[model samples]
Target: MPNARISLPKAKLSAVLGHLAKIPASLSMTTIQTSPDGLWLYQSGHGLDVQLCFPEARTESRVTTSVNTAALAQMVSVAPGEAVEVEVGPSGLKFGTGGYRASLNGLIVDYDEPPIEAEGGVVVPIAELGRAIRCVRHAVGGVNRPHFRGVQLEFSPGNLRAVASDGYRLARYDLGVDGPLNGKAMLPLKPLDAALGILSTQDGAATLQLHGGRLAVIGEAVRLALTPMGQGLPNVENAIPKSYVAEAIVDPRALIQAIRRVSLLSPQDNRRIDLSFSEQRLEVRGAGDYGEGRDEVPLDTYRGEPLALSLNAVYLYDALSCIEGMARIKISDPRSPIAVEALEDARYLGVIAPILNP
Candidate 1:
């Protein structure tokens, strides 16, 4: 029996497991392997594959094994000590530190060597990528809405853009950073969300690589291999109305506060909010079986025709959440969807479809 052993500081090991926590529970097997470069932990789920590497723990020989994910995570998180020890067993893996040791049962699965890097992959700016994903993820569709359940990444040199939609609402974030990727790729929502979280805890840049024709984001210790989701999210640029007859600028924070204040009396089922925009002012009204509530916010730079539009209050709240400073709303007509953008930053854009007021 070739037992593989690895040792690392407690915090490092805990950090690795913490990132793994973001992965969906379905892929419940952990694959441990040793390479000339270092020690690797791999798991796959939600049409995505995640791999973490510890380059400092290079061993002399090659060893690979798969164990139950939950068991491993539990043993590591609850185990005591400042140094972590791992050893492979015939059908399981052992974890120990100082005076504590535990053995976890393994799973009957095979993990062939997966490519961690390609010949020519791009290094993605972690801060930019994380922020971009956050800006657009809210608009991503739910499980039932499979067609729009992923994000489209328009990656090219000197520019990176991410767009997501759920048919009713669309969000886009354009980053003015440079990368070597030149084409577009669609990534499943869960994996992207996990990757975003994992990256938040990490520092430095991550790589955008193609492993067996699948796109992946490889961080210093974390690798998110995204299995592209469905196709044809609504065109973000085309979806934004080219011109609007009415526009209004309002402080997003204040508007959100006003919406929430009036929403206290709104009906739970629909929580409908009626928005009436006109010269230098905007009126927000929320109504339900409890009765109706109205709040007015003075608009800045209001122009063009007066517009009365009905929208779902919850959806409107989400639309405003991403906007920092002031929001400039491009209101075309009562029936047309409104375009919202940040006045201080042009990188983000959002569109919300109106619902029937009555």
Candidate 2:
């Protein structure tokens, strides 16, 4: 008996077919039946399946890949379609007239090279995108917090932003896009990291599409898609205090190196590093089991009050590291969080939570 199959639009159906062709033999592929609103990729003991659903016939195409067979079985089964025409090539896998059809672990996988969508969306320079992704990904929360462990991307006309924070520290970067796009999504750390690596190897611009919880980056010859993380990112921008007076400008690497040397002696309880700025001297010192080590860096100018205060050694280092140039750090008081700002090439701001001393 011929397997029963449903009809999917040419554009979407082609995408699903192409994805299967790209799967490596390390993974298996099998034919799937189309369900009422989606298609399922199924396997046997491996019990893995890729379920792709079309919520609205007009919605952007979506592809879901999974290795969980138990979860795949629960998904509704549908009639199978005849082997559609597909093709394989050396540059990369392609599908259409001729392609391989197989099942891996229980899920149908494709190596289809779907036709690239129309251009004229949001485009970001590969270098800028690569830098922003790498810088922010470092600050993402660890895997322990599945929800907050990704970089948040926000896009608007002429602006693109990426931010990451692991509660202890935060980092952000901004880029100027070629056109307009109003959308936001969270890209998982691992995939975002991979994308950065991919962008670094390529040149020119990459068009990014953030529709239907899907992120697609189209470079010169490569097209990549990732499912957006459906979790809330903390509002870090609003956390900055409105008023802060004490400001210190110094070298970022110098500040980081000083913290690293001093941290060796500072007690964990008193992760405190005291800052003394008066006349033409600026000093950062930490006290602990190893006694104390201080680095006094000369200042070009000092406008704030001569002040001494304690701060978390890590937070200060984190904010300083994010700044690309010499940093101007502001201190409000003995108990207020520190504000770190750099040259205004881009409107970037970061505030560290203060450690209150009893």
Best by TM-score: 1
**In candidate 1, which residue pairs clash?**
none
Which ranges in model 1 have alpha carbons more than 4 Å from their true place? 1-5, 9-12, 18-27, 81-83, 88-91, 107-112, 119-121, 209-213
**lDDT values for all models:** 0.79, 0.59
- Worst window of 10 by summed lDDT in candidate 2: 86-95
In model 1, the Cα lDDT at residue 2 comes to: 69
Per-residue lDDT tens digits of candidate 1, residues 259-278?
A: 99888888787777889998
- The TM-scores, one per candidate, come to 0.87, 0.66
Model 1 Cα shift for residue 193 (angstroms): 2.5
Query: TM-score of the candidate numbered 2?
Result: 0.66
lDDT of 2 by residue, 51-138 (tens): 2333222212333333433222221122134333222111212223223333323333443424334255688788878777665665
